[model samples]
Target chain A: MRPVEVGHRGGERAPRSTRLLGRHELPIACEADIVLVRRKARSLAQAYGFDAFATAAITTAASELARNCWVHGGGGAAVVEELYDGTRHGLAMEFRDTGPGIGDVEWALAGGHSTTRSLGLGLSGSRRLVDEFALETARGEGTTVRIVKWKRF
Target chain B: MSPIPILRIGTTLLCSVHVELDDALAERLQEDVLGTIERTGATGLVVDISGLETVDSYVARILADTGRMARLMGADTVLAGMRPEVAATLVRMGFPLEGVRAALDLDHGLALLAHGRSGATEGRRPGRTAP
Candidate 1:
């Protein structure tokens, strides 16, 4: 019922230092929420001075990652962060879920190999679009996927 | 808010999916397309995604599934007007448009369904392009 009941405890330290912008959340319960994530991520990337292709890549990756959080991970949350590593600015997203975690990390990221009749590009496609990507998960434990896309000078 | 508009253009059902597709909207569309097929005996369906440049995997699945569902009920489905960037994103993402009969443009989708209404070549699956 309460999709976004995760309490907006968004702003934290560490990432705030390198991530020089505000934090936004995408409360994923249903499909429409996925759309919201895409738009929000795109806008954040634009605000950080990413180009057209970079913007598209960011939004597209956001959409896929958010969908995975909701669809495969049994409804979770997405956090978008504006990052700046001093010289270059960037965008980072963290996807978290309490659902069943992935079994094989390698298999899941192999592209077009979904067990749920999906296009199977969520993990691999998203990784390719961004500058950095990391995944942490166990079978019973939840999953957390963090990705970052930095703007080019 | 009104559901996505399903326009009756001649004997074909034209659905322009320009809005950001949520799960509920996609399900509603599936139901409407199938219901319209039975209600109007329409021979073809065209879902225009030209206006939409971004979509997730779930949205793509819904479109593909909608096409497959329409086929079972004797109606052909043609997904039309995907931007090049969107197409590139989809391919790069590894989400195949399985079971989707595609047209590069809306007019092509309409033509593909209009002239090729045999309902016999449903299994073969040939793509169409607008002239």
Candidate 2:
């Protein structure tokens, strides 16, 4: 998929930033994919001067989301993007799955909640780890979770 | 990978696992431990967990499965020398260690086993000489 410009204002006075940042897509296959996603997220975050803790958190969050995709969704893909203005800025990730969508988003976001016998900290912990988190799901359609973390450096 | 050392003293077998007990190692541990129980006719087995850094769900499940498999083979399995952090993680993750024993170290575990075996034998035959 092509990267679309978002967060643009509808005014002629505002200058339009046309810089395209890095984008990556990876397939979630098995439990090992979780670790791979974490590593990839860490590298992307570190490349943008994000603090070590922030990078570690992003890595853990990515691992959680990727694991959910593998275990619950059967398989999915992850998209990562780095955004910048001047000094290294922020990173965002989108995880999309074709598995059965969540029936209760609110309940699922609560900590220690899980349908399977997992640690039940996937979505909740991931949400807490990032600066911004959003989820969209439709019954039988699919689920998409988006998260963004800003650089502390 | 080096084979986990197994020491058989009478009816009990002491196993020293010198590796991480993560998902990958858990698979190998299950196979090796279960296979040992089947072949050696051990009545009890002790698994050393001092080398593990963490116990995730997969490894926890493997430990539980190993216990069940040992029982099926007529052997009881106990976990020994779990690091405090690993124990805390397992507890937080709600992995039950019902039939497994957690000891502070290998020496302590061996001593406990020795005491239990001697006590059991003394109870069985009061006048017999202690081996």
Candidate 3:
């Protein structure tokens, strides 16, 4: 059996940006992977000169989204990309999975409603931690969440 | 793998989290802590998290639950040594540290625990010098 894949596939264009400084791909198959994702995001953000608060925020967002992929999505892939678009620098991450998709996007994003008895802050809190947030999912297909945090001058 | 060590000091237990914990490790730490409390009959737990870089919702939940569970077992819990940025992120995420006392550092945490142990119904200790 072939392993599931995510992020930018062949024929799918990369993110619209003038230059991508760095890119990394990681597979999220277990709880340890979530910790790795956070570390990867933190190092990348620090390398890109993110402030301490921004770095913490980025890493927290990565941890939350990666956990979603592992817990709700039943494992997936994460792609972290550093972006430089003319005047601004940014870090973007995409968490994708081929597992059962979320049935109610609204309810999931509402916060405090969880299937795993958690605080249910993963989706809602992650959205607030980043500068840009986008989620795409189909009930029977899969779910993909993308988030970006921009470096401030 | 060895479980996170919980050191006993007098009637208190000190558990310092030095690494980022996944769910399994966090659960293990929880069980170890509770079991230690049961065996030692400790009345206070000080969880030092200065080594942790980030306290996400999951880690935050584990800390909160540990505090609550310790309370149920007749123990007071003090969360110590949180980084400033981590604290800011936690507040922004709106995940409050429920039922746990917050201290600036390990010394303050220990002092608070000591105060709680000695002063069940007494007023503040005058000319109090940190132990």
Give per-residue CA lDDT, model 1, range A1-153, as digits (tens). Answer: 112111111122224357456788778887668888888988887777787777877898888888888888888899988777666787889998887888777778777687774668788888777777878786667788888787777
Query: Which ten contiguous residues of candidate 3 chain B have the minimum total lDDT?
Result: B120-129
Predicted candidate 2 versus true structure: per-residue lDDT over B6-97, tens digit per residue: 77888888777775443455677788777777788888878887876444554566777787888789876667787765565455434456
The iRMS of model 3 comes to 1.0
Best by TM-score: 3
Cα lDDT, model 2, residue B61: 62
Return the candidate ranking by lDDT, descending.
Answer: 3, 1, 2
Best candidate according to DockQ = 3
Poorest 10 consecutive residues of model 3 chain A by lDDT?
A1-10
The per-candidate TM-score of the B chain, in the order shown, comes to 0.83, 0.75, 0.87
Q: Between prediction 1 and prediction 3, which has the larger lDDT?
A: 3
Report clash pairs, candidate 1.
A32-B22
Q: Where in model 1 is the C-alpha error above 4 Å?
A: A1-19, A26-32, A49-52, A113-117, B115-131
Q: Which of the numbered candidates is closest to the native, going by highest lDDT?
A: 3
Docking quality band of candidate 1, CAPRI definitions: acceptable
**Candidate 2: deviation at residue A111, Å?**
8.8
Segments in model 2 whose C-alpha atoms lie over 4 Å from true places:
A1-27, A35-66, A77-96, A104-136, A144-153, B1-10, B18-25, B118-131
